[model samples]
Target: MGKVTGFLEFERLEEGYEPVEQRLKSYKEFVIGLTPAEAKIQGARCMDCGTPFCNNGCPVNNIIPDFNDLVYKQDWQNAITVLHSTNNFPEFTGRICPAPCEAACVINVNGDAVGIKSIEHAIIDKAWAEGWVQPQPAAVKTGKKVAIVGGGPAGLAAAQQLARAGHDVTVFEKNDKVGGLLRYGIPDFKMDKSHIDRRMAQLAAEGVVFRTNVVVGEWPQGSKVTNWAKEQVSAESLKAEFDAIVLTGGSEQSRDLPVPGRDLAGIHFAMELLPQQNRVNHGGQVENAISATGKHVIVIGGGDTGSDCVGTSNRHGALSVTQFEVMPQPPVEENRPLTWPYWPMKLRTSSSHEEGCVREFAISTKEFIGENGKVTGLKTVRVEFKDGKLVEVPGSEQDYKADLVLLAMGFVNPVASVLESFGVSKDARGNAKATTEAEGGYKTNVAKVFTAGDMRRGQSLVVWAIREGRQAARAVDEFLMGATSLPR
Candidate 1:
């Protein structure tokens, strides 16, 4: 509403990226955020739509119009204030979130959507540069203690909220550092690790305690979920010590392809290769680390994780990189008239895909072919939908050479052992069973225990994790004090 007809006058401008040639040389953030002027123009493009579908479209229900207006008026401080009100970590979402909000933008029905993510990026970066982001420690202690298991976005969000509500909050992270998947699963080229470290400092200053390298429950033996815990704390001890416990662990159990020769040495889960690269980037040594150097790499799955593998493999100087998806390729553009104000399915080309990748859709791997216990290639078949079921195409069998295979089909659920240790029940999908209602929501069948984020809702977006964390904090506060002032 800052400019009534501004939407008609402005065109969308996207954030820039460093040249692929220069960026592949190092593992650092390559995104060049929108300048203040460009952000203002982008903000001005926000139409004064009555419904503001973008707000509902965003997982955290951010006040999109308000922030857009603030940015349009050059009110940098208020823009960030509005942003942080809904999102605890805009930097993360601004960098990695797919911007479903933009898909639901009213302007996107016919024209390009306003660059909301870029504006958010500008707002948060400016806020930090101007020292608007600082510690907001609670003035009085509530005389209550809360334990948050997992230091990913959800756990961190809950810890910050509970700490600000005057409760003693401690976050237990199995890895040597916080930022569960963000630190290891996501490549540093998309978002630098410094963003997470900066937020950690702010949380610590706000009286949130972090216990890194500490697993609060048992880890399954020989599981490749990237545990770096140096110490262990029993679930019973947490229940005895803390007033409430929030399970916000990530969905770490990756879905596997059980075809023939899956036991090949060079074939690994995306997690196995990704986390090792991240550790190496952070100056930590990993023994026998998986590398793509001079190898023909095949990444299975077509999601963000697979795209990440593409980027990392390119950075590793792989001889060639190919990705596979069983599903048919989506249309290059969605029919906005039929899917307006909702997320629509369409072809998505990530920056990693733009770098260099041979994407094969409607293709399924039949078997992994190997030599001497090492992957050498894979047999595949083109698939087609027949009578509502996927069926292999006749005479479509083929083989492709590959030296390494990375399975990135996404995670299935949280580690079952941790839930078992807490005596928490799970949904049919293996995620912790919990509701999101206002009354007794987020509470598990077990006493004084709650679950949220990927642990409760299965693998999801960072924005959804933040939303669940904030709501779970409210639920816990209500359970501990019989009432809560925190927002749901």
Candidate 2:
């Protein structure tokens, strides 16, 4: 511990944000990262807890205390070194991850947790500014080829690791760019795309090949999953050409609300609207793009996706924006005594929610009311829990005006066709069937095929995806060379 009693002396300092009024005008990152002094102070707050649960709490098992100590000691280079040892992209997680590590911090049991995410953000940004982040090309070439399907976090992580392990790595991305969700799914205001671009350059320099606009498997026609792929490579060809294949595609199949009038126009999945906006932001033209301008927008789903819809709608100058959640609202604060060292269910307000949104909890849409094949409003019923099941409250039916309806209820599973093309078996949840066991982990029933991230574990956090990708890379390396030096 750099400062034994620093936790008792310092209060938590949150990262700042640009004014909502100014930020709503553009799609750019608005977060103000911590200065070096502030980050050092934050690092000093790390208590001398015997066991660092934050390490386990983090999906990638980052050595939190070491980084914190390094930061506290003003060893900026070593701080980033410790951060990169566990996380391939601390910038990505620092921006978007919910920081379950902070929730599990010992200081959080009674006081505010150490600002670990902010410190990480400072470290990475500083590292990049100081040119500490550079290519780490392998010392020796293994002369083995590996194909990573999907250029999202997991696939990118795997590609970087496998490339650094001296294997020829090629990442196939269906979109026109490498970052899958990071490029299209998340709004630029939340995380700028430049971060992804810089990392891609580093990966390329490290001997990883990125094949953009290339789909390695079938993409379902008429699917809302964003695809700008100009070339399609068969799974059989990849198996024949590459020594091993890792499927890290995201769970693109969005969960749908199959109520009445689902066929109405102007009602779309969050993916349909979000990806289009991102493309537009990237200076790409989209035909008949969904917009919220001057419309009453209703976003169904109370998760991060729904919050993003709220922010985007506000940016589009919508007449009004409302969000709906079927589940009851959680408590504003969790009971730390009971929920310490674990993620707790509590009311989470995202920056998007802070911008502007009318959040309605415990409400379920009964039917979509429309006029001339266009959504006009929706019928809803307030719900309550009864006998361990959700039941609509009697006489609680209501109607709300809505011109644009976005379903942001989250994704269900990966596109089934891609897995089918690879002859990979699927679990009950429709995710690729793969284990995380120490032996033969991430290996599918199919020969020389591995799965990880959302494709194998279902839709999850970016940190989780990175963890799975790193482990899957180790698994593939072991399978190919009968042993691996890469960390699990």
Candidate 3:
């Protein structure tokens, strides 16, 4: 609950961004968080709804109302406490989460909702500045060892919880560092990697062991997932060494568009383009890294990955950037009454889109056109939906110039070979087969083995990964001790 009339008195204030010209020069974060006073004002806008859908809307079930009330009272210390109660990483969610909680806010029915994400961003930033964040090592050791494969949000969250529950935890990652996708896939301009480095320090202080550059299972050839492993550990070895094993290695198999001229030079998966830039930003060398400079870049796919490509291309001093989507363009605004308190399909323009982009919907890439061995253009076709299926329209074929093409079509599943090595069953969608029931959540068919995050669910949000990680940790605890006090 907040001030009774606060929602009516104040308009929603969004976090500011640095000027485009200045931001394009570097990979640092550009978001300007709200001041303490400003955050308090936004928090006061939380209406006292009997049923708080904002909690249900959030994957982590963050105590949104309590935190808002705390911020309104200028109790920044307790605000972080309430925030960290359900969610482990408010900094990550506050910066990158889409804020479905705001969509579910009661005031959003007919007016702008409280700036929940901005308030959260401000609270966490202030908490870190005030030296409030500290490691919480368990009081007693359980002597149960857990091997967590993958160091993304899911594995990190699970490792922290298991360690807090007094279990010895070791996180295995193939990359040279922790933070999985957060370490590589996401652009630094959106969120600096320093956030992850600080969290890793906290985890280490809490008695969690991190083993980077170590692969848990086999990595298939030509995969897009980053691998810097100098050593490999087998599933059998982990099962023999640890009391329990959790697979949080995300779904990394990038989806491909196989069509004519698919093998042309200057065409690549978005992963190949994104992770290299991230490495270069961190002082690593990318020998033959793909560059968008002075090139006509065409990004395929209209999801967040495509948007990332657009922003990256612009940052690389690209000549022009264009994005294509197979689906019809959504309306600029959604019909709230028809789809309130849930994620609705509507046009969403990310900050990357604001930098500059030409977006085309209801379009399909017919074929990649090439000159010599490199991509020169793309043959495209406009299409319409008929009986809920895509159908090409006659006389809509068009050719567009493209010097470089980046496919951001999203991921299909986790690499199957890795799952096969563990003998873990897979769902129809190719994700590891596991239930979320408290009785048997995250348990794979193999004994002493569990799965969570994108490895179990398909490619999903980082918030969802954190939620699964926390829940899986509880499940592992319950299995180990026959009862668990950790939050689900």
Q: lDDT scores for all predictions?
A: 0.93, 0.94, 0.93
Clashes of 1: 0
Lowest-scoring 10 consecutive residues by lDDT in candidate 2?
Answer: 222-231
Residue 140 miss distance in model 3 (angstroms):
0.1
Residue 320 lDDT (model 2): 91
Candidate 1 residue 455 Cα shift, in angstroms, is 0.4
Q: What's model 3's lDDT at 302?
A: 98
Screening candidate 3 with a backbone cut-off below 3 angstroms (N, C-alpha, C), the clashing residue pairs are none
lDDT of 1 by residue, 179-274 (tens): 989998889998889999999999999999999888778877875434466788999999999999999999998999999999998999999899
Please give, for residues 1-488, the per-residue lDDT of candidate 2 as tens digits: 89999999999999999999999999889999999999999999998999999998999999999999999999999999999998999999999999999999999998899998999899999999999999999999999999999999999999999999999999988888989899999999989999999999999999999898777777678754344657789999999999999999999989999999999999999998888899999899999989899999999999989988999999999999999999999999999999989999999999888888889999999999999889999999999999999999999999999999999999999999999999999999999999999899999999999999999999899999999999999999999999999998
Residue 448 displacement (Å), model 2: 0.4
Query: TM-score of every model?
Result: 0.99, 0.99, 0.99
- Give the RMSD in angstroms, all C-alphas superposed, for model 3: 1.0
After superposition, the stretches of candidate 2 with alpha carbons farther than 4 Å from their true spots are 223-227
